[model samples]
Target: MLLPFHRQQLLRITLVPLTLLLASVAIAQSAPSVIGTRAVLTTWSDPIEALGTLSADESVTLSATVTEIVADINFRDGEQVEEGQLLIRLEDGEEQAQLRASQALREERRNASNRASQLQERNLAARADVEDSQSRLRQADADIQAIEAQLANYQIKAPFSGRVGFRNISIGALVTPGMELVTLDKLDVMQLDFSVPEMYLGRLTPGLTLNTTTAAYFDEVFSGEIATLGTRIDPITRSVSVRAELDNADGRLRPGMLMEVTIQQRVRDTIVIPEAAIEPSGDRHFVMLIKQSDETTRLAQQEVEIGERRQGDVEIVEGLAAGDLVVFHGLQLARDGLAVRLIGIADDETDIRALLEADR
Candidate 1:
């Protein structure tokens, strides 16, 4: 009976403290509220971005001009070669012998022509005979030149300075004209080729500056200038092909590198607001507008069309106007025409990027 009396006293004390805690919570919840706003009057600007790829401005596959067996390869695969450097050699064989034979025939004809000239000077040869000997000498000279040119064709030289690709031909391998010997790419300067949609076609032009970045070189940005624009747009994609040239004097940029490119279009002044200020539902978009009150606040809903979005700021294309108070926070608890206290305008301009960094 004494223990029961002590427990009852403890319960009475706990009930009084708990009752006071619940009453305070209810009063505090009814006092004020936290809300966020975009304060729509902020200035806005929009920029367009695109993607592209890096490639060598000049690339080609080198091939031999005649049928022959490979005798030697002077350059190794993937080696940088200078203009006129010897790349490959083919067996000269019969061509060399032919050149020598033609040379001997030319000498014999020259000797015969010299004798004919001396006879003509002495009045012992007919004019037609001298003329025939002169003609034979000329014909022999032509044959020797032709044979020499054919012999020279056996040796292949690099046409331009560039990096050589993998070697496709081995010693003693028979190759015909037009067979790929190797690929030569001029990487000192590279070209970026990409397409832009027709919507931006009017803004595309030669000499436009662009900044390009690649996954391979994440730390660096490659700068390029527009070099060419396709005269015609593709009917299927409704896009135009654009070529930009970049200087790769350091040889960091390479061919076949996937890249993302950004080009800035025209600038326009408009009202900028936070993306959170707008409510998106199926095909409609709207924002909660805060109205002023002597001692309380009011809310109104307005439909809006959004424009270019960047860095968390979206352009207000229509509906919302400058100086319009846009609700950014406490939207879930807000309703159309709800009466609220101004308390004060919340600092809705929190850098969303900073919040992202904190999360990371």
Candidate 2:
């Protein structure tokens, strides 16, 4: 047996180790629980966004075709016009008089030809005389047709149905050929022109749906579909031009309006988890994975490769699989190989997205 002093020292050392072990057990039992969620296989898409401009489906600037004095202005400024609608009439007095005179002469020549044919049938006129009268009749008809064509040139008609802009010419104004009269635009369907990086050329195709927003209508979102793609990529910017068509039946969208566009390609299936589960350390990412033992659940430190992040979920590109449980809350309280209590599972019914949105 040892002396009293040696026995006291041995007892002290033995109690210290036993007390420490009991304290560790108490801490383990009282460890805070965390919410976890299983990594799920879901569809995700990569969205492409760019700035674009809105244009009319069709546009044209109406102009005068001949140098003449404007005699009549039928349409008001900024009015809707129908195709073939007479818009302006120039000074056609001289042309009208010439047409009328030619028409009267044509009628006279036709009567002469008829009379000559009758006389020839009766052998009362020479064949040469009949032929000469018929030739003069044909010439008179051609002159009438030429004069009528010239008269039509004095009138300006709408070539298509569209909204007309402000007119530049007024009645009595002398206008020359190619002089601006007004602008016409078909606004039933609008075109959105934008550019994307050349790398996405393979994915660009007709009929892809897209959404757009404009400053003029901030709360409204317009929908469209890809209508055309440029033949060649722009060498200087390394981008490809794309055009999308949007229905504007309400006439809310106008030409030359600036807009923001977003195009989504296709959905891809991948493993996803709540972003709260990630424990970033330096350049690497970690997660507290929940592992079930024979009678208890424990935490295991897992390193993962991160991919695209959207909403409140992050994609696990590697080092994780579907159905794997991961701790999303109380990550600070977790330790490697330590036992833990699971309070809840973050799943479809958990409203995790609402929580994330509230946090934001």
Candidate 3:
């Protein structure tokens, strides 16, 4: 059953070529083609966004100082009023009558004091009578002053220049002391209250500028500067409170309006790579570099440290350079030091073109 010597030699020789062919086919099928790209270097400004709210810097609710019926409402709802302008008048009829009576009594006391002085000069009146008349005159003057002050309180004046809110009291309504008449808010300037993490405390200062936009007015962007920093940090949130003042001269911004604030952080030059170029394995991150020859290409693995990420790009803090070629997609098919064949990209436009041509 054994083959002849020549036949056996021919079989062994053919076996070698067959084995080589199978090996080449297996290697080609096992490895895959991966599309890649180069990491480009660029500088970018870093910005952080936060949520905030708008509020009036100056606001107050005017109220009655004395208990009485509202006699007159001088200002309409939502009326712009100036400081010291009369806004409301309570029933001052009683106070007015009391003031008039005090004034008459003060006149009579003055006359009595004068008559007493003349009698004393003529030695027709004792010193005690003159002293009593002087005391009565002083008492009458004090009573008149007290009545005037009380009557002035019946007329409520605007505390500051602002727009009045809806009237809380109507004419002829019995009003008690400390009863609210209407609300007022100075809208020429507004305060935006927001918070930032304690880590940003150093970056935020009294004069730092920021940009803000509201949901109600999405297209409009308002500018503001830091006005005040909280002396104490919130223990629960570990965040510091900050406020910025915005000039709303046109009265476009309303109190209680929600707004979004953006703060630009300090910029630093660093190497950046597209997010697609980075491959993560456990705690390690890496990329693949491609080098080509005349007939084949090769891939090399690289490790890098990544920093802050914005949009679709990640910053490279270390382990990368400006000219590093990185695999963009199909990284799962890549292997260390594997030969490759680029299916596309002409030699004229490739970085590996010169290297490949030289090798040929």
* Model 3 spans with C-alpha error above 4 angstroms: 1-49, 111-135, 267-273, 280-305, 317-360
lDDT of 2: 0.89
Models sorted by lDDT, best on top: 2, 3, 1
Compose the digit string of candidate 2's lDDT tens values, residues 163-252.
888888778999998888889898999999999999998987899999899999899999999999999889999999999999999888
Local distance difference test, each candidate:
0.80, 0.89, 0.82
TM-score, predicted candidate 2 vs. hidden true structure: 0.77
Give a tens-digit lDDT track for model 1, residues 112-200: 99999999999999988999999999999999888888877898888889999999989999999999999988899998888888898
lDDT score, candidate 1 = 0.80
Question: Against the true structure, what is every candidate's RMSD?
Answer: 10.0, 5.8, 8.7
lDDT of 3 by residue, 266-335 (tens): 7667787778778888988888877776745788888888888887789888887777666665577787
Models sorted by TM-score, best on top: 2, 3, 1
Show model 1 residue runs off by greater than 4 Å: 1-53, 267-273, 278-307, 316-328, 331-360
lDDT of 2 at 263: 92
| TM-score on alpha carbons, each prediction | 0.68, 0.77, 0.69
